[model samples]
Target: MINMKRRTFLKGSVAAGAVGAAVSAGLLTPRVVLAAWPSAAFEAKSVDSALDALMGSHAVESSDKISIRAPDIAENGAVVPVSVTAPMSNIDTISIIAEKNAAPLTAAFKLGKGAEGYVSTRIKMGKTSNVIAVVKAGGKMYSASKEVKVTIGGCGG
Candidate 1:
């Protein structure tokens, strides 16, 4: 049996508590705590509003450099696989928009400097809609869209 003395236990607990307090106070940090998780953007009813909430504006130009790899007809809307790739320069972020969903903004991926502009994930869709991929590069937004037809509806039919 490992016997932890009362004084030693109290000291250890106090040290641990102090460390936690320091982290919370920004004294020790890489800043892992996310108190600002963009809830308003995800809950937005329309695509424009979602984009505004997320990135301050929705105006974006079409770009041939961007490509979306998704099935022309998704057998199930519950987990339709989608991938966006942009073999371009200076990509800052990649955001996916489901144009007809209740909350159109489905996913947003922020990239570090020089990181590859590519993301893949499964997203839910309520009906047939154009899935738009918006990429931010050099402080400008470029986009591309692909119509995805769903067979079995996922977002509340």
Candidate 2:
């Protein structure tokens, strides 16, 4: 390995340390971090409230076209894998909701133009509840759900 001069090493370390300290102290935050987060929706206690806050209304049309892929029983509720597939064009947004969670609005994703109508991620669940997938497409809201039994609670159970 090429030896690094003491001066060079010290300079590199100082720069890294300075950047780290600035970030930790909230002094050098990038504007793009947590951009356009639906804070009110995420903080909503009830699923209906969350849906209303996030999607303007909870009234959705049940559709077989949307599919939610998840395990029937999640051994660890802390990191349950969930996948949503809405094989329809003009999809605008996809959201995942865990009905029993304190903050029932687990995750939401906005799809760009012509983007795939699919989203996959892990979400925490407090208990056994229905995992719902809501999709907004063509100025309409469609949804589907599947019950997920959590053997071990994830939200501080």
Off by over 4 Å in 1: 1-35, 153-157
TM-score of each: 0.73, 0.73
True-structure lDDT of candidate 2: 0.78
Report the lDDT tens digits of candidate 2 across residue range 28-76.
Answer: 3323323568665676666666666666567799999889999998889
Alpha carbon lDDT of each predicted model: 0.77, 0.78
Error of 1 at 58 (Å): 1.0
Candidate 2 ranges beyond 4 A from true positions? 1-35, 153-157
Count of backbone clashes, every candidate in sequence: 0, 0
Q: After superposition, how far is residue 67 of candidate 1 from its true place, in Å?
A: 0.2
TM-score, prediction 1: 0.73
Tens digits of per-residue lDDT for model 1 on 1-157? 2456666556645644554454346553322212356665676666665665566557788998899999898878888899999987888779999998866889888887668989999999888899999998877889999999987733432
Tell me the deviation in Å of residue 76 in model 2: 0.4
Instruction: Rate residue 2 of model 1 by lDDT.
Output: 40
Highest-lDDT candidate: 2
Q: What lDDT is obtained when candidate 1 is compared to the true structure?
A: 0.77
User: Candidate 2: lDDT of 62?
Assistant: 92
